[model samples]
Target chain A: MTLKRLLSERRAAILEKWRDRVFACYPPETASFLKREADRFSNPVAHRLTEGLKGIYATLLGEAPAAEVTAQLDEVLRIWAVQDFTPSQALAFVFFLKPIIREELAGELKADAGLTAELLDLESRLDGVALLGFDVYMRRREKLSDLKVSEMKARISGLLRRVGVDPSTL
Target chain B: MSLPKPEELARVNYQPPARGWMEVKPDFRPGTYCNAASPKWLEWIDYPYPRQWSVAEEDWQLPENWKEIVLEGMEDRLARFRSLKLFFDICVRCGACADKCHFFLGTGDPKNMPVLRAELLRSVYKRYFTRIGKALGELVGARDLDEKVIKEWFFYLYQCTICRRCSLFCPYGIDMAEMTLLGREMLASIGINIDWAMASVAQCYDKGSHIGATPQAFKDMIDFLAEENERITGIKTPVSYNRKGAEILFVTPSGDYFADPGTFTLMGYLLLFTYLDLDWTFSTYAAEGGNFGWFVSHEMGKRLNAKIYHEAERLKVKWILGGECGHMWRVCNQYMPTWFGQVPSFLEVPVSPVTGTVFENARVHKMVHISEFTADLLRHNKLKLDPQRNAHIKLTFHDSCNTSRGMGIFEEPRYIIQHVLPEGHFFEMPPNTIREKTFCCGSSSGINANENMELRMQGGFPRANAVRYVHERYGVNHLGCICALDRATLPTLLQYWVPEVEVTGITELVGNALVFEGEIERTTDLRDRDLVGVGEQEGGEEEE
Candidate 1:
């Protein structure tokens, strides 16, 4: 019913679609590795395999991963190899994992009959957040909270300016 | 009279600030921003509408119901080129080319991505010409052809420098720049044109040059060169224009005719030719060697090139040697033979009158770059050199993209530098970004005139950073390049972002090093001297 719940739902839907497509493209070993990794969310090895899957997803979506991403991944794995549970800890804290979890949760909310109307309202809010996030991501990557607040501020300013009430004056 | 110090050379004091013309409403609710869910993001985002091109009102008139004519012309051209068809069909939407682009890498703008940029044109070609595209429109993710799309194509296609760096990384060897050029040609048929390109094409047709200098201007340029030739060498190099029966027809970009550093380079070409006693004459008729229309369209390209061939025929020269201009040589050396007939048999073999070493199989008629010509002269001990004249500054060569990559003229320019300024420093930018993979002047496509200054600056910043890097690392102060376009455009960038580095035509540096036959006078008051101190500590080397 909440905006976060709605985003989760939409993301889950998208992920389902993405998984199907990825399965079509990837080899059997990669597909099985991804499937097992996706289910074992707490395990560090599973987390790494999931991270690799995310990279494959980004590449498939026509977004070339930056060189920094590869270096960061390598650093995380190297540190993890020396310390048990470190890979899982890093994966749990990985910036991109939050979106995947939110999307899966939102998908679950969509399946609930009582939350349908609330889910719809949440979807509308999620839409604005997603749009702003994507636009910023195209130029730069920013945290979800930062993206949302900036979008809200920009909107408020635009409305104020249109009504001849300068937000800066306020 | 002495030239002002490099610090005193007029700086480009122009900057375009962001105007508050467009308003973005942050709160406006668009549907959920599902990049995968919504197809809109996949569709081209048309932003910053194209400015209405200000040409003559009559020029705006569609050529006697041009819509039909244009449609027919597009069909024929699209059908004629199998390469275009193969290129459009082969791209697998791989993102390998995204980071490889200097433009995309610098700006992080998705539109600059080579794959995305190619799609701007490719989408239209699919919709209009291909049958599969028409049947499965949005389902196959194709958009209908429209006026708005056409305008966006024009704006973005010109943004490409045709550097062909993306082609190197493309798995299928698909040249997006080539597609962009072809798209421009198609648009030109429909009365869509850029004034900068059209004006250049018209100038080449009327004034025997892209810059539109008259015969008198050429003579005046030569006269000025003669004076400098006397000053530098104490030898009066007899430079003449439109002189018939000369063994070779010397052609250079018109930038050399009017600009200072370019003029010095022209003098070096003249002095070297004289020292070698190779009979060469500058034709006032075809004074300009580079074709701007090559960036615009093929028809205009053919029209501009006709003048060069016509002049070559009229002068009845055995061979035509092009000066150190980038795209000009690419056009002449690579494209000219295909467009024009086989270069004349006599023109094919360039026998150096000095050494009589015949350059055999010169289909584009035994044309030598000024650097090669000068290097040949230096190899034979033809020019008197004083390396200390160059000692006032450290020098390095920036291989012009077209000359190095397009023609493989890497050694000759270096040969001239080693021979003339043996003591001068020559530093190389990282291998991938220089020589063959040289970044464009950011304004070389001829589309980045005053109107698109922001785009030019963004695209050019990476190259400026490279020059700044070499300047910082090796304490190389002077950046010598063989391309006239680089000579003209790179300086503005250096002035804006990397003001410390001075760019010169390699020939000009050679001219500076030449020991004239007269009085020895040490003059350091040249304008554009010491504008920026070499190796001023700043940001350490950072990769773009």
Candidate 2:
């Protein structure tokens, strides 16, 4: 069977492994809360991670455009951006899929060179997802810096306007 | 140079830490904490132990007897404040408040949980003050007050916005915000402080405002606002500064003096006062309604708050008319009178001059929220309002945490909104997310500093999540609130999370909808954006 078919069959297990691994990045108490709380609004960090991962996995397997993967990762990565993660750790979840898929499809990979080549191609797509995650993460960081500047400037914008120094021009 | 293999990295242990929570030291990550207090402000204010320090450094350069100071401070507070002592003794630890905090819900940091955040202090209170804790150390869930404990206290207490959402859930009514204030007080006693709060305290002390706006600067902004109001409404709004013998002394947060959206609300106040021809004056000395000192220590908060009553007495106003703010009003409603040693003898109860309705609710406090004042006007049919002017925007109200819980002001803003906006234009966020159970903007109680945007975002997740719901479901374009901090912080929050929705002060909407007599046809809202169809309806059917 082709690698795509194998991945399709093992999608559930792979996703579960991926979910736990991503959650494990948080402190254990927080990880458990994120894993167990099912309400979308009550547990948004978990909700976004679970939902964003599913979207990413589906798009990765399908012939969807590259933008779709980035879109899927945006929400999850946004949470991590504001979290206590370094850039490497923030984008680490994307690379995490590689080993889980490899371990899940270990038997099929060893048996056929064709399947191994297909795995390599698929792994490159995962790399693409990781790069897209970097873009999303960096974009969030930039947004944060911009937010800080604007909030600070906006605080005094009224006074600035009265002083005849247009804040927007600055 | 090589990183760990993917499989190796994936092998994360999901086990709880063997060492209990007390043993886990806080990681002073860059974005996690606010900048340390500047020694310049400390020395200017003559705060004790003025020295340069950095939170990022391994050594905080704390005073040598920091532990004794913290313990003694805690003991003094416990003995002096009955409420603090009662809260410490009363927590059943039922964890009812565990999931309630927006910070906890957003960050999923277990320490952000209200029970645990308070326990950070309670554990020390146990080890140092209680017999059971001393006899059975870790067994009784107590630990010694070490340097790690101090760091943890600083980290978690600042994380709390003191919204009191947790207290609503506790059966014993355990107020975590009060405990946090106590925690922050102890921290300050040891020469520890957050810059965002302390800097503002010093500025407010020196320059009579939080942003250090001089008396002229404050008047300049108001003059500009009046000019803008005239350009929009064709009626020049009259304003006064430091004018004595006015019937009311209007005090608002300094943010409203210089922040967007807040400035619009200030315009709304100016227009309403002009329309009423109310005898009121703005005291530049008492310019700031927000008490950042409230977030620091009680003594400091009292020192900062004393300006309002003093200004009132000097100006000889009948009463104080406060603008839309969360913590300021919380301070006014709960602590101001007690802190001021009783209502000023010169100030009469706030009787609305336009409506002649005695504000019996504020009889003792002798101060009135603007919403209450406006709602009273609306109830008496005192203002000419065109609800259709707000037709272009779909709106929702976010109850400011301080007003919702501290004062129980659930209806006044809503009453004003109903009178000024189209009947169906308003929508509530959700039953659980508003009113007394309202979520914080996650940046209240002096956490709205720029350096700690990550904490603000993470802590604001629950609030933003609810806004996203209304934005998607009902197409809410405007989020109206009555808090200065909300106006300052919620805009950044919505821009990041739900870009479609915008934040506005409730009074801004009122300013947009108020119809001036003999005015030219309205064209634009206070922000100068074109109002839909208002300018076009020159000679058409009346908007009665």
Candidate 3:
């Protein structure tokens, strides 16, 4: 079978492993709560992570366009960007899928050269996703910086106008 | 392969440290804390022990007598405020309030728990003041005050928005916000203050508003808003500032003068005041209704709040009409008369000039909430309203925490909303998340700084989660709130979590629904967004 077909066949197992690795980045107490809570409104972080991961895995298996995958990454990484995570740590979850995919399809890849080439291609796609996650993360960080400047400008616009300086120019 | 395994690329530590919470020092992470008070503002306000300090540094550069000052401050507060001493003395630790905090729910940090957050100060109270705590020490859940403890207090206390959701769940009725207020006051005594609050305090002290709008700037902003109102509704609303003979002096948070969303609410006020032809004036002095002093100390609160009554006497207004604000109402409703000994004799109890309704609820403070005033107008049919004007929006109300819990003025805004919107257009968020159990905007009480966006995001998650629910389930695109700070912060909070949802002040909706006699047919709401169903033709370019 092709690598994409194999990943599709073992989608549940791979998504489960990926979810654990991503959830493990939080504290133990928080990690377990995120795992146990199923209500979306009650535990939004976990809900967002779950829905985003499912969308990402489905899109990665060629069910949707590549832009759909970036949209999924944006939803997940937006949470991590503002969270207590460094840049590397924030995007690390995308890479975690690589190890899970390798382990889940280890036997098929070793038996066939075509499957091994396809696995390399898939790993490269995963690397692209990680790079896309970096873009998503930076967008959020830039938005945060813009928000800071906007908040300051909004706070002081009246003062700026009084002193003969246009706040909009700032 | 020459490289290490892909699984080992990241080191994930899910386990917390083995040490108990008391032993753990606060992690001074960037983006999670606000900066220290500036010496310039400290000097402006004459805060004691004014000096430079940063929470990120190892040494905080506290005063040499910080511990003594804190202890003395505690002792003095305990003697003065009976509520503080009672809250410290009576706590069964039932954990009812442990999960009630939005910060705790959002961050999952044990210290964010209200019981533990209060215990941060209560533990010091135990060791320094109580015999059992001194004799039993850690066994009694008490620890001696130290530099690290002070630092931890700064981190955790500021994390709380002082929303008072926890006090609702407490069996003992412990006002945990009072503890946070007193803890923050003690910290302020030792020259530890955040710049977000101090800057406003300094500005309000000198320039008459939190954003420091001068008398001219305030008028210019009103003129600008009035021009916008004329463009939308074809009415040129007359506005006055510091006018002596005006029957009513309207005081609102200065945020309405400059900021988005809040400025829309200001436009709403101008439209309503013009529609009513009621005599009203905005005060340049006492321009800000939000008391940043309440976030600092009782004395500071009284000092900043004194301007309102002083302006009323000078302007010779009959009574004050407060605009949509959270903590401002808390100060005016609960503490204003007490702080000033009584409402000034120059002002009479507020009787709404249009409806001729005596606001007996505001008898003691002699100030009426705008929502209360508007709801009364709706009840009396004093103004023309067209609910179809708000037909384009799906609405949900976020009860500002202080308005719900502190003042219990819940139904007034809802009553006005009921008259201003169609039946199916407005929906409630969850029953538990509304009214008394409301969550904070997570950036109020002067903690809405840009540097602390992460903390604000996390703390705001619970409230945003509810908004997201209505967004997905009911297609709610608009969130209505009464507080000025909520108007400023909830937009950012909603944009981050639920990007499709937007925030508006309740007055904005009312302004849209309000009909002026012989006025031009409107095509836009207060924010200049196109109104629904007003001019759209079927099968035309306007078809979505």
lDDT of 1 by residue, B1-544 (tens): 5663222211211112223211111111111010010112111111111234332222333345544554566577668877777887889987777655655543334456688788776676677777888888655646665555554565567667888777778999888767878887776665566655656666677777765667876677677666666665566678867788888888898877566456667767766666556788888888788888788677667667766767777888877788889999888777776777766554546666776656653545457666676777778787887666666557767777788867788888888888666564677776666766676677776754544444555466567666766887888777888987887666656655456787777776666666655544535212223212222322233321
lDDT of 3 by residue, B228-338 (tens): 788888999888889998999999998887887788898899999999898999888878899998998888999999999999999999999999999999999899999
lDDT, model 1, position A41: 16
Q: For model 2 chain B, give the 10-residue run with minimal summed lDDT.
A: B7-16
Model 3 stretches with alpha carbons more than 4 Å out: A1-21, A36-38, A61-65, A95-125, A156-170, B1-5, B10-15, B343-346, B533-544
Deviating ranges (above 4 Å) for candidate 2: A1-14, A63-65, A102-119, B1-18, B533-544
Higher-scoring candidate on TM-score, 1 or 3: 3
Residue-level lDDT tens digits of model 2 in B42-160 = 77677877778888887888899988898898889989989887887888888888888899888878888898888888888888889999999889888898888888899999999
DockQ result, candidate 1: 0.02
Rounded to one decimal, what is candidate 3's iRMSD? 3.1
Q: Arrange candidates by TM-score, descending.
A: 2, 3, 1
Over A1-170, each residue of candidate 1 has an lDDT whose tens digit, in order, gives: 54344444364564554344323222232234335433221122333334554553343233544433443343233222222222223232232333443355655555666655654444343333323333333232122233334323332332333344544355
Better of 1 and 2 by DockQ: 2
Give candidate 3's error at residue B318 in angstroms: 2.7
Instruction: Give the range where candidate 3 chain B is weakest over 10 consecutive residues by summed lDDT.
Output: B6-15
**TM-score (C-alpha, index-matched) for candidate 3:** 0.90
- Model 3 docking tier (incorrect/acceptable/medium/high): acceptable
RMSD of every candidate to native, in Å, equals 17.6, 3.5, 3.5
